[model samples]
Target: MVMWWLSSQPKGQRQVVVSILPSFICWHIWKARNKAVWEGISLSSGDICHGIIQDVVLAVSSEVNRWNLLPFFDQFFDRLSEPPMPLQCKIVRWRAAGTRIATLNTDGCSKGNPRASGGGGVLRDSEGRFLIGYSVCLGVSTSLLAEVLALLAGLRFCHQRGFTQVRVQSDSLVLVGILQCWFQCSWQIRREVFHIWQLAEDSGHFSHCFRETNTVADILANEGLLHPLVQMKIYNHPCMLPQLARGALRLDRSGFPSLQLLKRTPA
Candidate 1:
């Protein structure tokens, strides 16, 4: 109504009327809601919906009238009635020549100086099929150092397997940022991590994943402590290491890695 009124007046009157009208309506509604709430008056869902529709209609109508597009309101209403379909997410695969690329996920864990740590890597083809998994123990080290080592080992494994283009994934945000050149590492592990960065750069592509999305690598890392130096191979199936022996691997009171060798051999 304000916009229609402004359209009848001079062009200079449109902006002032449109701006003040919405502010006035918003203030009025806000004051009304507060008064009702303070007076112990409950608002129904219908009332809320009515208020929302009123606000939207007021804004849109004001803009349309100010622009003298009242005649197009019918077209806008028709379009709004049948909204466009949402876009679908499509997965794009990267292939070179005739071979598809590979994606690798790696993670590291330390239990106790060097800390008793383990690193894991999983290789998958472009079709998301598992190729192989690699996990190794780090005798002692910081978590960041373990992360760097894990990535380096993963990339090296991929390179050795003739993976020309590889996508690496990790749950370590710090390690991923450092590898992607998005964050700078402190002098503590800068020199040692440089080699890891170089390995990632040499690889085709890499990605950072949250821990939820990186459960495979996370499980492998923790399992590495149980089956240190043990490699299990499954034919035509995803391989998984058995659970860690109970009361075998213990963390020190200080929360460091403690090695208590169990009496079990890999079959």
Candidate 2:
């Protein structure tokens, strides 16, 4: 019926008329399914086909009458009898082929080697838009676990938001190596770490960065150590670190071990 109506319409309008039927049928099926599922009713395949036919017939008849094109109805019906060769198609084309994706920075801080820990993540788009910031407290666990958790959360958040590519910056070289498949770690951390790595791989692209460049996430992780409700808020404020603040940031580099696991203040 839709093809018939389109054929009877002016040549210039045929494409526009034919293009609308696919969307209309898709919506019609969706609504029918919703009604059946939510309204405690069931429709058979025959019933669905009948409904579609009835709708198409009514629509075609109404349009013909409204446009005073009854004289062309036979030709329209003849056109409807033939299978439609769709000239328009909707394709899933990539809009951001070479465009860079948002960058995510993440870090973990533990008060003890296998005790109270905290993790945080920060996301910034290619245009430098602050997309999301999050921090969370982890129960008794290893620093490795905390690090892995931080990466997991960041990747999960990005995946949920449909981010195709990302650079995940972190302070843990061990974690980065593990993610890059350059090191052999424990089975426990390896399992979760592998999952996170796979998630990044399934997406378009991702990379790791050093802690020096991941200050925002580092601060958020440290702050999480002091507050449990920190994750509920989004930090949109500009991140800045003075000399002292930079010094205060803790991670095991060479001489400096993570302050969270240290027994006393550094001299």
Candidate 3:
């Protein structure tokens, strides 16, 4: 019956709904059973369905923009009582590190979540002179894991090369939050995060930057996808990077600005 119902869903929604429906139903059912057994409170069928909807909403809310692109989710959101949110544009620029300190920027890319992932990082002195850069091909990994591994590699390199008092930056807000203990660490990347903390504990300072500011690192991360599996390459000069990446590095050193338009979230 469940399979038949799932198959009956609209073609565009069948895959998405099928992926989540079983887990949602099973989880809610288990919770309801526990509640009834322990507290002697029974949930009606409508109540159980409501709980599932709420769970689904919460699960996908973080990536609302992406989900809203899908026809099914777009219509689902349109039916909500809340008004559609407006968009906001803001200026973003790359800023140099403080005098006498080195800045390390890192980024990760995945063709698809858990597919063809890679990590990369670049270190530069206060004057924006590139000191070192590295790219790693991470096989069959999630973007979050790639980000964590990239950060760990950068921190480890700094520690080994005696680059104390370094400024660590990445475009991944969740990664920066994890390093600062502002967000809960997921089990998947907890171990790598531990290693990152160990290397950066005393000498490193962490910050989250916009993608515009971390262009070089982002480029390097994408380039890693073409590298051999489990391979890591180090570059000491801008010329060692791809042509476009070299241009981005030159602009970054010359204080060029990149603009990013972001939507304002409702308070």
Give the Cα lDDT of each candidate.
Answer: 0.58, 0.60, 0.79
Pull out the clashing pairs in model 3.
none
Once superposed on the true structure, which residue ranges of model 1 sit more than 4 Å away at CA? Answer: 1-99, 112-114, 202-204, 228-237, 240-267
Question: Candidate 2 — which residues are off by over 4 angstroms?
Answer: 1-99, 202-208, 229-267
- The Cα RMSD of model 2 versus the native structure comes to 23.0
TM-score of 1: 0.48
Worst 10 residues of 3 by lDDT: 65-74
> Each candidate: RMSD to true structure?
17.9, 23.0, 11.8
- Candidate number achieving the greatest lDDT relative to the actual structure: 3
Global lDDT of model 2: 0.60
Deviation in Å, model 3, residue 43 alpha carbon: 41
Instruction: Give the alpha carbon lDDT tens digit for every residue of 23-67 in model 2.
Output: 656766887799898996777766665555445556655333322
User: Candidate 2 or 3, higher lDDT?
Assistant: 3
**Candidate 2's TM-score:** 0.48
